[model samples]
Target: MQQPASTLATLWQIILRLIEKQGLDAEQFSRELGISAEVLRDPTARLPSRLTDRAFAKAEAVLADPAFALRAAECWHPSNLGIIGFAWLSSRTLHTGLKRMERFSRILGSRFSYRCAMEDRGLRFVYNHGRGDWDVGHAMTDFSLSILVDMCRTNIGHRLEPLEVTLRRPEPADTSPWRDYFGCKVRFGADEDSFLLDGETANAPLPTVNVPLANTFDAILTEQLATVFNDDIVSRCKAFLLRELTSGEPSAAALALALCMSQRSLQRRLAALGLTFQGILDETRHELARRYLDDSSKSVTEITFLLGFSEQSAFTRAFRRWSGMSPTGYRGNSAFAH
Candidate 1:
């Protein structure tokens, strides 16, 4: 199932948290990721979906801690920390909500899986990525951890710091800040990625205002949250365009009919988002071309046909317009640079 774009909001939330923890310059981070700092600050900024993956990976490298991503996710808003997280908090007895989070997280995405268990004196939360783990980059992992932590904290009405934060990647120069914010021992090069919480701290009571209000908020938040993933028409349309671009056959009318919408309405909605079907098509083609050129052993002719180009010359012209170089030249330069 397609996850909501709000998942991206969760990513931005994680980025802000890192800023708070490390005091790293936002502009520098943006430059390192080849994005604009202004976009990072703007909650409504429309990011190219692929860039989210890239940014997270780069940020993880710079921060040197895998949990940095999760920390950022915890601080993201449009959250249900009060509702979804409150049930465990309001229980008369001690209970960990980590498993509950794993259950309901499908409203988020199925790209990753989570498992939680009660340990000897604490709780452990493990994150496992799905197939095409290529997409399971830094940003996604960080956002996942952040949301889980935030949910736990909000449920209990107190900041429940983790006992330990572990990462798959090696430590970065910013490792000290991670330790400071987590207020715990931080480990890198671990067997698996996870966060641990002390059992005593796990059962602590939180300061929530109204348990009843939490129930009401949960319903409201759940409905609003569903909208994030329920728009299948839009996702299908995007997918169709992506697949057809190799045939150079992306068409608004065809996509609209396939989506059971009028072309006019589709165009208007996309316009509101500062995108057009053509722009999406071109961007998809550009991204795919870059990836193929970089990774594949295919000839220029084969790639041109695969991208739906009528001829090599046409593909060359478009490639030059997109990247300011012929495909072969770009590939040569990339190989040389590497």
Candidate 2:
């Protein structure tokens, strides 16, 4: 996919703090950046990702520092990333935190889809920008990656160094800042951007783990992310479908009402998009099943109903047809494969 249209408002909050610390007024900064003060102040609001990118560029220009991102990214708190941060902090292990991140990262930013794939030796969290070129600039990428690494380190109470840090940006003349911060061989001019975590370190249980707290935050993040993407007809319908799965299969009328539209109009709109309600529901179930399988918290039997399947056998058969494996088998393989 290309970059998401918007990013979480919490990102702007972080940048607001950075700019304020530099003796700039928040309102002034918002005006100067052509961002709205109203939008910047709202916790649930999503700023245009391009606006935040502009802030990054403006910050660099104001500071006259090519490496301003390094300064702005320092000393992140758990609450800085909103619920996503809290969820990660309360996860049972680094692996669990990563699962929460893979699921809920859209709450923070969606420009890059985060994929957590396990290696025999370690875990790889990839920043996949997807096909076609979209420049996020080196500063934004560096700032985001640093916060991620810092968040992991804070959660585990360990200076958990990655096995490697790869970037697409060109090598700077002074590589010491990147090298010293990552505490690894930071590879510039790499094929893609990623962090490689040591398996033993990532899978180890953490003292900060709190399952109930983490689950609570995860649920909120899901609902919040849903509302964030609910502007469009397809997204609104899809969000309703995912929530509907928990109770049982939802009807077209119910989904239409949820979107405040009638069934006939809903069908007409969907048809215009070359989609059918059944097709959308099937796709939603398939995607939700794969996601639910990733979390060790939910059981196989529970996932069946969660996808609105009447029986475990039905779910298994459907899953086999979709993924060519049983739910259990798919769950097991997901840890070892992408």
- Name the top lDDT candidate: 2
**Model 2: which ten-residue window has the lowest total lDDT?**
128-137
Measured against the true structure, the TM-scores of the candidates, in listed sequence, are 0.45, 0.73
Which lDDT values do the candidates have, in the order given? 0.59, 0.75
Query: Model 2, 4: alpha-carbon shift in Å?
Result: 9.4
Lowest lDDT sum, 10 consecutive residues, model 1, at 87-96
The runs of at least 3 residues in candidate 2 whose Cα sits more than 4 Å from the true structure, single-residue gaps closed, are: 1-4, 20-31, 34-39, 102-104, 110-113, 117-121, 128-136, 211-216, 231-238, 251-307, 311-338
Per-residue CA lDDT of model 1 for 48-76, tens digit only, reads 45555565666655665555554564355
Q: List where candidate 1 sits over 4 angstroms from the true fold.
A: 1-49, 57-100, 129-159, 171-175, 220-338
The alpha-carbon lDDT assigned to residue 224 of candidate 1 equals 38
Per-residue lDDT of candidate 2, residues 1-338 (tens digit): 23367787766777887677666686788888777767655767777777776786677667754555655557466666778877788876788888778876766776656788877769888775432223446776677678788878887797878999998878878888888888998999888788999987787767887766765675577577667766556666777776778888899999888888889999998998899998888877876776566567889999898889899999999889877899888877634222
